[model samples]
Target: MTNPERDPESGKLTERYSDEDFLEAVAELEPASTREIAEAVGCSRRNADVRLRKLEEAGEIRKKKVGNSLTWFSVE
Candidate 1:
């Protein structure tokens, strides 16, 4: 199967899996847990944490602390 990402040439995604993977995970998933992103990205939990942290620092992702735990979400 082809990559589920958008083709730069064709300008069409091979499949919605890529976007769905992220969107579905975030849909109504407010106050998201670190584990949620890991499951969404289909990566290691530690790896997910790192990616999320980077995105957050870059302002690509937004995170808020609900008590001791942090709930992450995408800004746009």
Candidate 2:
């Protein structure tokens, strides 16, 4: 399959999924966590959290509690 997004020179994901990229990843994954996305984006979990929250507010992501911590996922 073709990649949804990638850096032109390095040919790696430039950052955490854009809204569209996150949607693509979520479509391919079960509910995932902020840390997971953060690692994939090559950023700090805290930074990912910020972007994730923005996505959530835009109705691109959904957050749910799993045990003491919360995991974020793309919504239908």
Q: Which candidate should be chosen as best, given lDDT against the real structure?
A: 2
Q: Which residue pairs overlap in candidate 2's backbone?
A: none
lDDT for residue 10 in candidate 2, whole number 0-100: 89
Error of 2 at 13 (Å): 18
What candidate 2 gets wrong by more than 4 Å, as runs, is: 1-17
- On residues 1-76, what C-alpha lDDT tens digit does candidate 2 reach at each position? 1235787998987554465555555455547777777666655788777887888898887889898656877676
User: What would the per-residue lDDT of candidate 1 be over residues 1-76, giving only the tens digit for each residue?
Assistant: 1155778999887642344454455554756887876676676677667666776687766888888777887686
* Per-prediction TM-score: 0.57, 0.63
RMSD of model 1 against the true structure: 5.9
* Model 2 / residue 59 / CA error / Å: 0.5
Error of 1 at 57 (Å): 0.8
